[model samples]
Target chain A: MKETLKLFKIGGGVLDDDAQLHRFVQAFAQVPGRKILVHGGGKGASQMLSDLGIAPQMVQGRRITDAATLDVVTMFYAGKTNKQLVALLQASGVNALGLSGADGNVIRAVKRPVKDIDYGFVGDLPANSVDAATLHTLIQAELTPVLCAITHDGHGQLLNTNADTIASTVARALAGRYEVELHYCFEKNGVLLDVNDDNSVIPQIVPAQYQQLKADGVIAAGMIPKLDNAFAALEAGVEKVVIEHALNINEPIKTVLCRS
Target chain B: MKETLKLFKIGGGVLDDDAQLHRFVQAFAQVPGRKILVHGGGKGASQMLSDLGIAPQMVQGRRITDAATLDVVTMFYAGKTNKQLVALLQASGVNALGLSGADGNVIRAVKRPVKDIDYGFVGDLPANSVDAATLHTLIQAELTPVLCAITHDGHGQLLNTNADTIASTVARALAGRYEVELHYCFEKNGVLLDVNDDNSVIPQIVPAQYQQLKADGVIAAGMIPKLDNAFAALEAGVEKVVIEHALNINEPIKTVLCRS
Candidate 1:
């Protein structure tokens, strides 16, 4: 039987560990589907740029990417992130085509100023701009699409974006064609109900419980954004999401989130 | 009578037409100093990248830059050719400094990769890492440092470079020092040189030369690289480079090169 088509969201946490990324690429090469890999270059890029005398400014953790920062980010994301991922996947025998949202008009976006405050060079991706025909061509060629968080204004200019959001939008664009699954992978052992306790695991979150947790503050702190995006995917029509604990790398377990 | 520190570069030909690059970011703000800018983009990046899509794999001109394309050239010369120009002049009136061969611990270069082989990133600059002192403290204080085409290897990550390399490099690094002079303002009347007339009475290159002659003959296409970079600087640099004709941008034009 053929396996399900999946849309994987490789998190910043997974990218933080180079070794795990290497191993994950190995296993992924052995898998199926017209896989689209999207990545986040958090801390890594900002830190390097900072060390080089750049202090990042953002309205809400969203970097106010002007021109200089854009150049640096391009080096990190397009030049470093995508390149490394391509190298790793290629090493593992995967035919991966690394790309930016700008190439071949693959994905286009509108420059978004931050909440009425100009974020200089930041952008918001439009749903219609996600060109599915271009993507189909790549999949038909049997090449894996490894993407970075950066995009373009389509006039030869690039924009900074949240990688996870990019993956979500991409998944949303590509749903229903196949058994599309967006795997949000991180370095944790799974979603932990109790933060302090490592062994505690929350196997699933149904629609009602997902809402209740938000009401009762069971899911407060940082988990808010992740869950919000997870649910956004569910609402957008992806088959389901597997928020797995990618700690061991080899032995990945599914902490599924079903909408019911 | 001493005047302002005016920057003047001789573009390939495009700047001849687009003299608007010179007046873009308020030239009155430049700190009082002597200036002469020499630029080259060869008009290759646009046509060349486009050509590579169709041409055979010729190692020198047609080979596509893989993740490996950036290895040597992106880091080192990106600054030398592109970003440094943007980072250096883009906020001139507002204190965007200049950078080039003479700056403190600037661009370091690694040798070209093996002719046909992928060379791991090369080129060495004095400070691969931009120190807080340069981007933040220094420029904010109203000292304009004009950087020629160059970048550093920060921590041994040497890079190949091109002129007008880091187009928006300066703008992003020093967003606070907003204004910039990226593409086009030059001494020449713009790209207007005689293919056969050689009388040189035009006083400088003009826009007409950019379109008319380009189609007629190759016009020693090697000169295309320099002009190519000047155009990129507008988008890459914090401000716009007023690329004009070479003869009048500044005084004391380097006679040998111009008279060639």
Candidate 2:
């Protein structure tokens, strides 16, 4: 039996709050087995941009990542946040190593093609973008990689990427070698039957149940894309996908999606 | 019988200029065998700090690394500069992994003790600060480590460190395993006999020569600390120390200091 690798992704909610982030780090450090952590940029980047007087550029209601925006986010995500997390993890005895996609060419991305909307300096991962072999080597050497949502074009350009996509892609890439479990940790408990009820987490959802839930409109509209992506990862060979609260990762109350 | 490893240190002058940095990256890419690059913060960090309205704290004419200053420098050095260099190196076909001391517990440092002046968040590396075994594993895995001048207290506190000290210490730590050559790349051609003459590059300097030059007041006051560190690295088992221009690293017109 292949050893299991749990890849956890945290977003703005946990990252933006210092106490919450530390609590999450302490919880994450206790997770056993080979693990990876992917983190998204927090509100800090936007705040810094605002403080520096760089206005956010948007077109057609979609945010554009200009050169200045990219620089700030890169510093915030890859530099300040990532290093801080690594130090915290190390203090917790997890031996974490922080990385951008540029590090070791772990993930090479393609710049978003200029459509009617030019999302400048943004990257979309192509197939085989995650270098699984290198990651495997690092993991085998007993190092836990903490990746940020920054990728490169393999041609000297650092582009902003989505952390969720990075988590799924890395899970899919490593599926052939490890029993991959991808965890999307956020503020909510899990997939709720009643959106207002914090205790209404659906423990398990296979592909058919997920489809039914979506069709029944039981799932929140905001969670549709995330669920769609999770199920796709399940179909693509990832053993399981878990949606849980960042603080309660060790707890049993969560949603698990698997292929039936 | 040990394999050769070239460790290069670059300071603010080259890093602050894009063209010079790219040129140095191109030259560095041409270097063969196992290598590492340690870089100092550029003017960008101070610029960002100023833009963010974080005033530099000083004590008795010595710069103090206050909490605010530490955060900005960490973001600047570990985030923007380090990632940019890694991406550029990746573009140049080198598999580079960026690291702060916190990563992999690579360089755990002690918080500088409060003397007459308290330098908040400044780290002082003691003996065995560099994890040579981990570095060896990374080097043997074919990944070139690109380190920034940020370290951690191993207790979740990130500290600002000097890049020159990091370079010499790393070189010394790895001396037992590799034929390590430490390179300090800056603006000058080499250790010039005449401070104003760019062409007066001293081809080689031994302990005796260095002493004579200092006694004769031929060496500039600013070069004393750097040269002293380089010699200490040599005495500590590093094979040689090279002082060269960042843009002209692959060229031969440089100063090579050796223990004789």
Candidate 3:
């Protein structure tokens, strides 16, 4: 197979619905090359968790997973989300394994906060500690690595993070990692022109307009940071940044947040 | 209010299934006492785990949790399952929080094996190293304790132990520490004569009958061990062990596994 695209960043929406998540995973397994799927939880996990009386806090758009929240987030996002993705790939005849940040020194980071704000444990990756080589070995064995969006900061703490950040960083960590296509799968059709209207799909977004949409308040409620993520991922050396629907990932919008 | 039960053992089944899990937890909350819930996975966890290509391993009827299995198991059984149960309880107007065997020295164990078979890092409680007093203060602040069925040996290794075993041990650690009432929740009716036939519910079985059933294969396979657990719990000084449906745990198994 031609050098495989190494990273796929799936949004929280895609991870929420079991059926959609299973399908997205199946597509990745069919594609030729090494691939890792990184996902987050949409309102499905957040709302239920909130309804359960726990408010989710975020620092720099990543979840601040406290001890109480870590328990829920790990179960919902790490175990349930990660394992289910692996299951779908497996069911589709793909060899895959579900893992956490603690599996084999896979991903490490240091908890980061907004200085004065108390957003529990969110992390910034350690200096070049992500060993994508070992992951490649696993990939060589034909096993797809389904990793959760969490990191261990080495100082006796685990950190909740953005799946987009995790996926793109993993891509940057490997040599020739740039060939990996960074895909952001969500419930909608990429970033929309008018965020107030779900049906007004943008079809494409550039770095400049993405910021403009945020300034206009149309994207502020939800879609802003996610698109910024798609932007940041491209900035971090991913070959292509694709924003698409989980139901129909075959048709992706060219939301290039950066110039290659 | 009466002094609350010191340690609550949360069954994993109660964690994943929120609807059923919430009702049962609320009943405990209304008991006018401090309490803790130690939980395990319902069928969702085990099935999902197998989905990730991690086969279930057991020796002497206890989980032989390996590293690969342990990583996923910790996230699933302890991390995820424990949190969901607490969240559900807290959502249903119960101030619930989760604690694991690894958290704050709550559960201590060693990398133990079953009958000298080397079981990797499955936690143990030994005589008693758990500090229930610290947990008591949290409950006194109106928080419900939800625990995972994991513990550490004196070493830093995480251990994989049976939820029943975890529950029993935690209860024992709390026997004289606090006035504790222990309940065992599962999907099926309390110990049956033949699991193949649910109507063959034993209703009541004395030690001699239990022993005879084990010899006669009537209480064979998994049943004998479960009954043994019930007996062991009684001997360890738990006021009572009720094997009831997790959904409606208000009524316990009156058959009572204890001395007359």
Candidate 4:
């Protein structure tokens, strides 16, 4: 029997607010079993960049990561936010160790190819990005790893990566060894049946029903990509995927996606 | 027989210079057996503080770590400097992991109490600061830990600490499990016999010779505290302490302190 591992990913919404972040931390500490936390870059990086007089570079409504942007984000996400989270978790009695993808060469990414727009210092995860063996070793040693959204090319370049991609990739990679449960924690309660209604969280989601909901246009356009990604993770051997509010992780209200 | 572990400490001089830092990383990679690197904060943090409009807090000719200063230093040391070193080491085929004292609860420190001068967020490491068992686990797993001088009180406050103290404390803590060699790497070749001559390196110094050198004023006053700290580590069961140039670590002509 494989031991279960819960991997939770929280984004800017929870990270940017101190009270929410602390509440989430307190709730996260109560989660039992082997777990991992993958966090997204908050507004702090953009603020720092603005403070440092660096202008944001955008192409066709998409933000481009230049060298200066990468440095600030790396310092903000990997340094301040990650270390602070680790310290907070430690204070709550969790043996947490923070990591950037560069640490232990754990997640080696490749610079995105210049096709349409040149996204400077941005990385895309290849098939074999996450090092599962190293992660398993850490998990077995009773340490919860807090990973930041910065990865490195094997040849010494730190690249900005997507936190959601990191979470799924790590989940897929660790599936073979552990029954992996990937949780996406955000502001919303779950995949809401009524977009305006907070309590209309669909308790369960399977692939077939998800397709029907998409066909009926009941699922929001914004949620399709996330659901598709969740199903893909399920296809890639992850046992379960949960969508919940960052502050309500230990609570029962959530959307559970499973392989039927 | 205990396995040999080489712990190297490098300060601002090498870190502030890109070429020198890379050279030290290359030399450090070539060293065999289990090794760890501890680094101090460079001028980058101070520059960032100035750029961010945070003034230096000073108390009677000594720099004080105010809350703002602590935050900036933590980000710079534990974030930028530490991650860059880890990436560089990974590029050189060394599996490196970056750490703040809060990571893995590796080194829990106490915030310095208000004395004549209340140094706001500075931390002082107690005797039981470094967690040797966790370090041993990391070393045995073939991961080279690159530690920055940011530690935390167990109560969740991140504290700015002295890197030299961190190195010696870690070395002393791990001496029982490994035959530890603590190397203090700096700009000069070694401890100089004539303070004026750069090449006047002292090859070896025992306790009696150190006392005599101190009495005769042959040892420069600036080097006394560092040397005293080195000798104390020797007495605390560390097998050896080497004082050498950061770039010339692979070369000879360095001072070695030993217990006779």
Q: Best by DockQ, which number?
A: 2
* Candidate 2 local lDDT, A1-260, one digit each (tens): 99999999999989999999999999999999999999999899999899999999999999999999999999999999999999999999998999999999999999999989999999999999999999999999999999999999999999999999999999999999999999999999899999999999999999899889989999999999999999999989999999999999999999999887
* Cα lDDT for residue B5, candidate 1: 29
Q: How well is candidate 3 docked (DockQ)?
A: 0.05
Tell me the tens digit of each residue's lDDT in model 1 across B1-260.
Answer: 21232334434453323343344323423424433343544343333234334232344554443433443233322222233233223323332333332223333344344667654343332223333233333333333444434333322232434444433334323333444443343443334455354333233333454445567764447546654444433333333344343433442222111111
Model 3: per-residue lDDT, tens digit, B99-131? 555444555565554575767666655676565
Question: In angstroms, how far off is B147's CA in candidate 4?
Answer: 0.4
Point out the higher-scoring one by TM-score: 3 or 4: 4
Could you give candidate 2's per-residue lDDT for residues B1-260 as a string of tens digits? 99999999998989999998999999999999999999999899989999999988989998999888998899999999999999999999999999999999999999999989998899999999999999999999999999999999899999999999999999999999999999999999999999999999999999999999999999999999999999989999999999999999999999999998
Measured with C-alpha atoms, the lDDT of residue A4 in candidate 3 is: 53
Q: In the order shown, what is each candidate's alpha-carbon RMSD?
A: 16.5, 0.8, 16.7, 0.7
Candidate 3 per-residue lDDT, tens place, A1-260, comes to 23756566677656666676667766676667667777765655675467446776776785566776765677666554554455445446555545555543467666774676666767777557576765665565455667777666544355677776777678667535336677666666666666556667766666677667777776746655666666665676656667666666665443444452
Whole-model Cα lDDT per candidate? 0.53, 0.96, 0.62, 0.94
Count of clashes in candidate 3: 22
- Which stretches in model 1 have alpha-carbon errors above 4 Å? A1-3, A58-62, A114-116, A247-252, B1-260
Candidate 3, B230: how far from true, in Å? 25
Let me know the TM-score candidate 1 reaches against the reference structure: 0.55
* Model 3, position B34: C-alpha lDDT score: 66
Spell out the clash pairs found in candidate 4. Answer: none
Q: On a 0 to 100 scale, what is the lDDT of residue B186 in model 1? A: 42
Chain A only TM-scores, each candidate in turn: 0.90, 0.99, 0.78, 0.99
